[model samples]
Target: MREFSEAYLERTREGMWDDSRQALAPLALDSRERVLDVGCGTGELSRVLVAESAGEVVGCDADRELLEFAGEHVPVIAGDALRLPFPDDSFDLVVCQALLINLPDPAAALAEFARVSTDLVAAVEPDNGAVEVDSSVPTEERLESRARRAYLEGIGTDVTLGADAREAFSEAGLDVLETRRYDHERTIEPPYGEAALTIAQRKATGAGLADDRETMLEGAMDDEEYDALRSEWRAMGRDVIEQMEDRRYRRSEEIPFFVTVGRVNGPQ
Candidate 1:
């Protein structure tokens, strides 16, 4: 599995669930008794689970530090997705958000989720390949794609697994019940906050993009090509910062996430 830094996780999940709940309707959380959020990083989804479900909610993660952070909101335990600490039929509902994409063998993890859950199993995952970015700077559109392609090539797990989670559920011997598409839209606009300013600064300095240079190089990009990309990336960032200073920068991204819900076969 790919380990994400606390900063990265926070950045990606900052405004998630802020605009939508339709995707969660399929879980029928009100009817659930106990809900386990697997690989619950920093309790983002766990908080939502608690809000939506009347059942007991527990957050589990392999990272003790993240678990500690998550513990502030809900009951958290140090646990792995492929090998949950609980016994069979431990919960009425088991779910994970953005967890499957990081696992090399998502099927095995799903099988484990099915093992512990008595009824429902759900996974909320994003299709990185389908990411759409609209920015004031036109170059950002192209750069994002190039960067995303290199990222997908360099990443270890199936980043595009969101669209096929239902297939994996079936393979894990769970009956596919429902699938919902939730578009997590992030808009970078007026009244920019600390995070937005920090991100813009990182881009202007190229330090953040540089962090991913090595990973991008793991694919087909050579050093020269990387240097060129960095130059352009920096330019784009400078423009972004200028726009921010001028109060003219606006950007939006729609990340398509699929919420797949299923049920355990046979009896509990």
Candidate 2:
């Protein structure tokens, strides 16, 4: 599995925290409740929850690299979401963001969430069923391609859980209180645009590009040609961003989850 480095995780944290915090604002947290953040990448959300709730927040993740970067921002520990280190009913609220869909056993993880949370559990997960790509590609092809990529990225079997998250919570015996959709659009600028190009290049490289394509991407182009290629790539990203702004090119979608106070119906 290609785990993200601490640096990359931190970068993502800085860039995406605002949208995450906004997605969480509707949860109506109590000021005195203790919260648990499962898969708390870089402790960004945990920090926000602590500050916002004026309460204690503990974050847990399997990746120590990310947790090391998260040091002291919030109380972070290295552990699996599927088997949390905490005891039953240890936390009043549990919040997981962009974490469940990537787990090998999402149901098991949710069971753990239900186990540890006494009052409520809320999770924000991507809606794979709502994924929209460019109209130029067939929807089925896009879905298959995304599934293959996700599998390669080590998120386990492909399942569209966006519409099923509520059911999952209910199965874990938590009452589903609210489910909302949040739309986010990100615009990459200049060199950052080049980084996107680099990612596509890497994907193509990994996917076995033709000799000419490989050569072009492997620095065979002249300085001017390279600059032109980068410029073209940046232009393409801008175009995609514009299309997304106009609801043309669809890239991502998420269902922000909220489950109210409940208890496990059976043995944990």
Candidate 3:
């Protein structure tokens, strides 16, 4: 599994559930007795589950550092997604967000989730391949897409596994119940925040693309091509900073996340 930094997790999950949570209705959270959030990095989803569910929400992750951060919100334990610490039928519901897309064997993780849960198993995963970006910078969208394509190709797991998570559930012997689409929109406008400024700086220095250089090279992109892309990306970043200074920069990125819910087939 790929390990994410605390900052990266926070940046990606910021304001995740702040919008309407209608997509989570299929989990039947209101009636849940005990909920287990596997791969619950920083407990972003676990906190929301705690707020919506009458039951107790426990978060589990392999990263002890992240588990410590998550402990601030809900009870947490260090555990692997493929092998949970609890016993069979330990919880009424088992869930994860942005977890499956990073796992090499999603079906195996689902089977483990089924083993631990007596009722529902759900996954909220983003379809990275379908992401859309709108920016005031002319080259921003194109550069982002180019970088994203190479990164996706280089990623070991199925980063694009969104609604398709149902296939993994079926392989794990879970009955597919429903799939809901939720668009997580992130926008950057006037009065740029600390994060926005930091991102702009990273872009200007090519630090952002440099971090993914190894992965990008794993794909069809060679060192020469990556250098070319990085040059363009830095130029775009400079334009973004210039626009930000003028208070004319505006950008929005919409990531499509699918909430796929499934039921354990056999008796608990």
Candidate 4:
């Protein structure tokens, strides 16, 4: 599995879950006795699970540092997704958000979830390949697409796994229950705040793009295209910074997430 930094997790999850909860209904979480959140990075979903259900919610992750960060908000345990620490039938519901996509073999992890869950298993994942960006600077759209494509390819996991979780559930010998779509739209308009400025600053310094340069090259782009893309990427970043300074830059991103729920083998 790919490791994530605290900063990356925070940035990606910012403003998430604030829009709506309709997508979470499939989990049937109201009466759950025990709920476990796998790959609960900083407890983003754990807090939601606790708020939505009155069960004993536990957040588990492989990262100790993240567990510490999450412990403040929810009960956390150090655990791996592929080999969960608890015994069989440990909880009534087992769920994860943006976890399977990072896994090389998501089906294997789902099987683990099945082992621990007696009632339901759920996965919330994003279709990174289908991400849409609308920026005031039109070139930003195309460049972002190109950069995202390469970055996704190099990630070596099913970045589009959100759309395929049903098949994975079947592969794991689980019965499919329900699926829902949730579109998270983030807009950056006038009166740009600190988050916008921080992001723009990273782009302006070329530090942001440079950080992911190696990963973006992983089987996605050849050396020639990458060199040109990097050059243009930095140039676009400078433009973004300039636009931000003038308070005229505006951008919108839509990330599509699928909530897939499945049933465990037998009664608890």
Best by lDDT: 3
Worst 10 residues of 4 by lDDT: 203-212
lDDT (C-alpha, whole model) for all candidates: 0.89, 0.59, 0.94, 0.88
TM per prediction:
0.96, 0.65, 0.98, 0.96
The C-alpha stretches of model 1 lying farther than 4 A from their native spots are none
- Pitting candidate 3 against candidate 4, the one with the higher TM-score is 3
lDDT score for residue 244 of model 2: 41
lDDT of 4: 0.88
Model 4, 1-268: lDDT tens digits are: 7888887887788878888989998887788899999999888888888889978999999999999988988888998999999999989899999999988888899999999998899999999889999998767999888888789878878988877899999988889988899998888888987888888878766677778788887765888888788788778888998888888899999999999999997642
lDDT of 1 by residue, 137-227 (tens): 8798999898889878887788898779988898888999988999998888999988889888888788887887877888888889888
Error of 4 at 47 (Å): 1.1
Model 3 over residues 4-113: C-alpha lDDT tens digits?
98888888888887989999999989999999999998888998999999989999999999998999999998999998999899999999999999999999999999
| Candidate 2 regions with alpha-carbon error over 4 angstroms | 7-14, 17-22, 30-32, 132-155, 191-268
RMSD of 3: 1.0
lDDT of candidate 1 vs native? 0.89
